[model samples]
Target: MFDVAGLWHGFQIAATPVNLMWGLIGCALGTAVGVLPGLGPAATIALLLPISMKMGSPVTAIILMSGIFYGAMYGGSTTSILLKIPGEAASVVTCIDGYEMAKSGRAGAALGVAAIGSFIAGTIGLIGLTMMAPPLAEAALKFGPSEYFSLTVLGLLLATYLTGESALKGLTMAIVGLILGCMGLDPLSGAVRFDFGVADLQSNLDFVTLAMGLFGVGEILYSLEKSGTASILTTRIENVFPKLADLTRSGWSMVRGSVIGFLVGILPGGGAVLSSLISYAVEKKASKHPEEFGHGAIEGVAGPESANNAAASSSFIPLLTLGIPGNASTAMIFAALLIHGITPGPFLLKEHADVFWGVVASMYIGNVMLLILNLPLIGIWVQLLRVPYSFLAPLIMVLTLVGVYSVNNNVFDIWVMLVMGVFGYVARKLKFDLGPLLLAFVLGPIMERSLRQALLMSNGDGSVFFTRPISGSLMAIAIAFVLYNLWAARKKNRAARAVASSEAAK
Candidate 1:
């Protein structure tokens, strides 16, 4: 049950003129960060941490910081839909069908659905936070190493659905990603693994660098070869909002994404990126027209966008209730709280009800503001599609390079990005899917660490995953899904063979 009295008090604090202005400012900055590739919310918050200390009021500072966090979730889809560049790691899945929709002149619909879906999910997730934060945080604590390992395994298996038709190619890319993920020092032992004698390689590859290279620079290179102009202009802009048909198609997807994102976000390490990927996989698997997934499916844009936003909202649960930041962005917030002489934990609600409830109240307001702000901006973003690729290409390359370098201020990252961009271009030409590679790269470290921890805890027992109840259940589900996919592929192959035989007889 929700505390109506406490929530009302929260609204009082959030509705003050000073807090509102800061919230708006945070929202604007977050949107800018999301529109630009490579700059992430975590870095932005960390940059602003010193300024937050001067604010004097912890509640106001937190409201501003929280605003930026969720607002980025609303803005990330813009670049993905318009330019096929993922504005944030969580927005990577949006690039698949969102870019396709842009090419088909349905950019407006995709943007509209993403914004609306985000609003819906944000609202739903906040409500869940208000009503179920304590219980959910406790549930999240139940996820041990075995459970986390099983979960990552399930996520890896789901990566096959995100790529080329051939499971072999998807698995190969996943394995390659795992290898790439292992390029730095080992987690358990500080020994270097695959640094290739480079000092920079000793520190793991930056995900922002990799993402900007693979999507932004790679897209530019591919466009230079494939088409000299923007393909989107071939199809005229239809509307700035989603049509009734699109809304109908995406309604249930938004709801489902909200549920999945909130639940996943409660668990440690399950941040917006992971939730978005899981949401995309769920939508693809649930769709009646599964073949249409990678090709302008509105559900694809709607579900993942909704999910990431929901995850953004729900991710605060661990930080607030358990004093454990689930992701880097939340870790920054945890630091900010500490700087203000406020410790977040079980007694936080009793000791600092104002901070807890004030943040939650502001999130509700931020979601509304984000929806309004993002909707009008869709038309402006769509205009970029009118620019010729020849003229736009250099600008994109500069932004990609700048964004990649900004993350770590390292020139070596730029060189690495250039190499990865060339690799991405060559991979695209070879009909290879980059989605599984990125997904696996993100999950690989978590999976390895969890597997090692679980094994250590179980005295090197390999069957420990099957022995634990939660891990056992998740592992069983993964096995069943894999078997089902194999059976489906074999059935399809047999049907194709029969058709070939019939044509020969004819």
Candidate 2:
């Protein structure tokens, strides 16, 4: 299923001057966003949706977008090492040992290990993607409406269980997202639903508008509340190359992180952030000197950094093959495809092989580009960190406003974005996980259409989902996950009550 000829052709497409220029731009912008605290790749991609779409070439646009995805994983470690600030959520663990290493005069070594590990891990993940995606897409071609419906159900359930601490809250958010997804014209009947006499609501609430509001403006508002002084280490970095001994010690850690990251990244909600956290824990558990963790251990920085980048690389699998966006960044990429009238699914490889292979090849090039940028351009990122958040925040707001307005040229969409921004701000303050919400929102219409079509085919029989072999297996798995989540939640609640009673007695 892996085609050498196709890969070579992809490289040819990716290596063109125009594609290379856009890819470089995306990598640079991604790195800058990663080095900045408030801006994220998801939000940046969402903000740039209009601009990328206007380029009129989906392959070039996706190559640029994919570069930003993995490039952020590399750039995130800079602030973690230098200032104890995580520029990206996935880099949070790096702040522990990375900052400690900086204080211990090993900042350059830490950064070096992180960059090298990321490159290696990204390569590993890319290899996995190259091998796995085509076969999976072939298999998915056999999926019918029942199978599709069941798969979406399984995805939503897994996302609810894996992405959030509270399954109830996650499910609640997912339900809300489903309702929102239904708030437009019915795809099959073209009958207006949930418009409530508002004309803008008839066509449908814009996904780009909602995404920009929730991620871009919402993050800015939240960051404003928590803005404070960042303590930058004055330690001068020297020798960015790791010692041979250190490399030997961290070699297995990077490999383990790569494997872990790639496997986990295939899961619906287990993205770069979750993969990095899991990798750090695994490294800590596997290390002989576990106590050295959080106190300048090189493995601490190596494993998580590698894992995050690997996860970023692998997360595109579902988006390309199954048309399922595994994380927010990929979800934005999914939106980009839709903007170009390209539906991402089983037939995408057959129809748009250029977009698929070109993006993958570009990722290979982008990973190398990031390694070079991170190693030699540390000072550039450090200088970027000095730009006041005050200035950056307002500038982001203006961009958000301008970008959202440019979408449909409707002032009503701007108001919708502001309302969603407030909702996102409140959701964050209340500790609600937004991942499931967004994922459900994206999957809702798909699920609805699949279910309706399945019912029509079955002549209104619901058992068709359980009667088919593939759909039956998927439905069974979804049921198992739901039961497991409920049982786990119950156990957790019981434990919390027991601890509370014991403390009260004491």
Candidate 3:
């Protein structure tokens, strides 16, 4: 379904020296941040959104941002292997076997396999994106307001289910986001709802305020609170390439991980974290010598690394095709496109073919660049962790200030950022998962508009959502999900009660 000629044209744009330079810079920066603990791609992208806007075209801006994203995916394993600390949630699984490998003098080999696996998975994801996104987008064009509304509802449901140990917490955070979304003027009546007499509230809170403050500033504050003693890795060896036997054994793991990651990432709330975990679980289950899993198993390193990178790449599909972000990072990407005066939807491919395909083409080049950089410059990425947190913290804070101020030179916005940062910090301590909240905040406005449009078209007929074929199907799925979760919760409660009863009888 993809336009071959248009894709080729996009490569012509992405292959240019200027764009390539941007990609390299983004990769370098992304790698640096990815090696550091407590910094993630979402926060990094939020921090860079201001700079991306200043770039000439939407295509160039997106190319640079995409580079940062996948680069982080490639770089995150460095800390996981060397420091026994994951650079992000997704790298947590890598820590189990990766660090073990490092401790056993295969650090270089583990890093090499990770880089190679990530490249293969990224390529697989890109192919899936190229083939699937166009068809999915074409299908989405037929959706009416009701269908779109159902789709958003399903997205929220899936997100809640996939994140955190508690569904209740995810639902609570989503509701919080919905409430915050209502703080601005009503889209339909133009009547102020929750402004509380603040002039900025009338215009509603801009996304940058929420994203930067919540993800960026809040993260820093939380990290500072828990700034434990650092541990340094003193063990290392020379060769960075994997043996032929390692590659032979890990080839299937990489292939399977890529497939799993691509599928998971397309789902709402599914990102590298979940994909890597699932991949590891699958590898363990399928391995004949599952006992070797936590003892420097090559499969352990290959699968999850591949899965993480693949997930990162495929997560872009929803945002690029249907204007729906599958995760927090893509939500930021969605916001970036909107800020650039380019609204993404089913029509995006037809309207902005250059930007869409250019970003895709750039991923191919970016993946290759990352693979090359990651292998030879592995030493450089490890050294980044040596920089003191004290030095980095102030720089990030200063950047946050500059970024918020650059938006409109508004002092009020800076205050808003600080306020939201506090809110986010408190929320994190309270055990609320910010993933659902941030995504819901971004999707909330779109959902409200679609629902209102549907009602208007149906003359206030609430049944319109349940009567339309596609919308009905989606509604059914959402209802089914609710029922399934309820059943699971109830079953767990019953099991706990039975155990208590047994203890009492004894």
Candidate 4:
């Protein structure tokens, strides 16, 4: 049975004037970051982390951060639609048809649909979280070290699926990230694995520093490599609202996207980026006029924007209930919970009902706040797209440095950021996606810890992995995925060779 009493209490806390104001501030700040190129939800959250700590309560602080997280997902699509510049990886799909819609003078309609879809999807995903989280938490309590090890393996496999091009490349990058994660202290034995006699690396690499380096600084370097400077769209703002017909067309698309996105977000290591891409692909395949996909499809903007927001909202479930963050933003949310002396996991709902439900209740309010904030301000966001790249690029670099250095007040972190930036630029030029690498880095430690624990528990018996039903099933699925990917690659290569042979014969 649903706990109506708990929900009412949550509303009492979340509806307070102070919390509401904090939520609004987060939403505004998140939107600003989303509108700016080279800034992402992770970077924004990290930059504001210190400031959030100054707030009185953990619940209040997290409510603000969560608002920023989901709001950024909503705001990211604005740039993709208006200027074809994706604010984040998740919004890339939006650029295909969203910019085309803008080109056809339907920018208003696109923005309106995206905002409305996000609002609806966010609300629905929250409801799912509320309904599903308690039972999930209960199940998590039964998880042993072996189960957790298997779960982490599943997460890495899912990440490979999300890597865009080649599974082999994704696997290689994931292994590299795992090795990087091993550069410091060995948790079980307390022995250094690959520190190479460096005292600074004794504590291991910081997640914030690596994330900032790879995502923030690396993105800036890649952006600088483009031939032309940042070109903001100068299209006149006309028709700032969607037509009734447009709404009718996009309503079901939003609903479908919301369902799909929420499910994907529940999976470990899968988040808004994957949800948005899947939503766009699904909508395009299902549309009556598939050819319209690359040229102003309303469904394109509506579906992906909705999916990304839903994914962002649903990602909180694992973080709050399982003490496992589904994505980077959720990882920060976990950090906030830890700062509050509130450890999240199976006991979280029992021990901190107020905090859990309060955060949930605040999500409802945050969605309403985002809708109010974004709809009328679409023009302002569009105008921001006009800012020149020369000015914006420098600001991004400075912010990246500040954010990285502020994490632990360490200069070494800054150097790490620069090196990662160079690596990111080179990887981008080589057509390798960064999504898998980032996922691998985030999950690496957890995977390593779990594997070691599982091994110890199994008395060093490798067969123990296949002894439990859940672990065995998960391993079976991973094996199937690998085999399927190999077969697909072989088929693709054969087809290419046949085409080349035909051309030669001709």
- The sequence of per-residue lDDT tens digits that candidate 4 reaches over residues 1-506 is 56678778889999999998888888877777787766778767765665666787888998888988988888898889877988776788999998998888888888889889999999999989888888898888888777777776777777766645767776777787787878788877898877668777888787666666776777778777664545766676667578999999999899989998999998865789888889999999999999988989999999999999889889888888877776667766776676677887889999999899999999999899889778987777666766777777788788778767766788888888799878877876787756566666756777888888888888888777778887887788878877887798899999999999999999
If scored against the real structure, what TM-score would every candidate get? 0.63, 0.98, 0.98, 0.91
CA lDDT scores, all candidates in order: 0.79, 0.89, 0.88, 0.81
Query: How much is the lDDT of residue 116 in candidate 2?
Result: 94
RMSD of 3: 1.3
Model 2, span 1-506: residue lDDT tens? 67888788899999999999999999988989898877889888988887886897999888888878788888899988998889888999999999999999999999999999999999999999988999999999999999999998988888877777778788898898888888888988899999989888998778889888898888889989977657677898777888998899999999999999998998888889889999999999999999999899999999999999889988988889999888878888998999998999888989999988898899988888888888887778878888889888888888889898898888998999899898988998887877787888889899999999999999999999999999999999999888887888789889999999999999
Put down candidate 3 lDDT per residue, 1-506, tens digits, no spaces.
76788779889989889888898887877777788888898899899988888888888888888888888888899999988899877889999999999999899889999999999999999999998989988999999999989999999888988977789999999988877887788888899988888887788788887899999899989888866546668876467788898899999999989999999999888888899999999999989889999998989999999999999999988888888897888888888898899988899999998899989999999999998889988888777778878778879988988998898788898999999899989988988888888889988888999999999999999999999999999999999999999999999999999999999999
lDDT of 4 at 75: 83
Candidate 1 wrong stretches, greater than 4 Å = 1-118, 125-134, 162-166, 228-363, 374-382
Overall local distance difference test of candidate 4: 0.81
Model 4 steric clash pairs: none
Q: Could you tell which candidate, 2 or 4, scores higher by lDDT?
A: 2
Candidate 3 residue 323 Cα shift, in angstroms, is 0.8
Candidates ranked by lDDT, best first? 2, 3, 4, 1
